[model samples]
Target: MTKSAIRIALCVALVAAAAIVPAQAASGGAVAARSRSVILKHIAFHPRTAHIRVGGTVTWRWRDGSIVHNVVGSGFRSPTKAMGTYTLRFRARGTYNYVCTIHPGMTGKVIVG
Candidate 1:
């Protein structure tokens, strides 16, 4: 096949593959489930703490209206940009402590049992 035809065929294959792949699987399927959500308000985590089974997911929703908040764990830090929501999946059975970067005093914990 000619070079141009080969490129066209490759592009078509890529597009087809992309269309067939599920969005979640394409990203990463390790984290699955809508475990729970903790809203950020009054510069504190609404629930303060939560418990979930291992392999569960936790989503933090920033609800201070216009203020920016971040979910920072031991070594993981969510994007600093204003995010309406952020998610973290626990794969191990342990306690995880997280705090809001915008307000250090605002803290929360997650217990994965």
Candidate 2:
């Protein structure tokens, strides 16, 4: 094939492949459809980011061996606790970023769609 023709073919293939992939996946991010749980350990949230449908709930479990932490996100907040669990139900489709108020650099996010 001619150079021009090869370039056109490659562009077409790229467009087609992008159409078949989710925008998040195309951007090199992992999204879980039924993600309902997260773990708080070593002053960090396991699975730092999660994805779920609108109105889905995500449960945060504490397992840092007596280390206190809290999940503070946009429009939602959890009381500080060293053990047990906290649950938050997302109502809108958007990205929710959170952090540990006491621990610097501890962060997480949730994508609701």
Candidate 3:
């Protein structure tokens, strides 16, 4: 075989091997939801309730709006930010509730089981 043909073959083989690596790596890991999120909009939390497995993380993201907000719960308190995010990982199984202190009616819940 010509030298250039051998080089081209090696390049093709390397590309094929690279493509299979990610698929193999993903398949080797356990398949389970490990995180969730809620969006804090104008006056409420979208999907005010979320369900996640124990050891999963919950992220609260602030949307673009005039009014600022926060999340207060059993042991989690996200600082008020205009357009920021807060994340917490639950280690136990239970119902966790949170609310925005600035707004009376804004509430959310996280159920871990």
Clashing pairs counted in every model: 0, 0, 0
Off by over 4 Å in 2: 1-35
Model 3, position 11: C-alpha lDDT score: 100
Candidate number of the best TM-score: 3
lDDT of 1: 0.81
lDDT by residue (tens digit), candidate 1, 70-91: 8888967887645577888888
Provide the overall lDDT of each model, using Cα atoms, as 2-decimal numbers: 0.81, 0.88, 0.87
> Least accurate stretch of 10 residues (summed lDDT) in model 1?
25-34
lDDT of candidate 2 over 1-113, digit per residue (tens): 99999999999999988886887666645454455889999889999998888768899999999899999977789999999999988878899999999999999999998
Q: Report clash pairs, candidate 2.
A: none
**What residue runs in model 1 are displaced by over 4 Å at the alpha carbon?**
1-34
Query: Pairs clashing in candidate 1?
Result: none
Candidate number with the higher lDDT (1 or 2): 2
As a whole number from 0 to 100, the lDDT of residue 12 in candidate 2 is 100
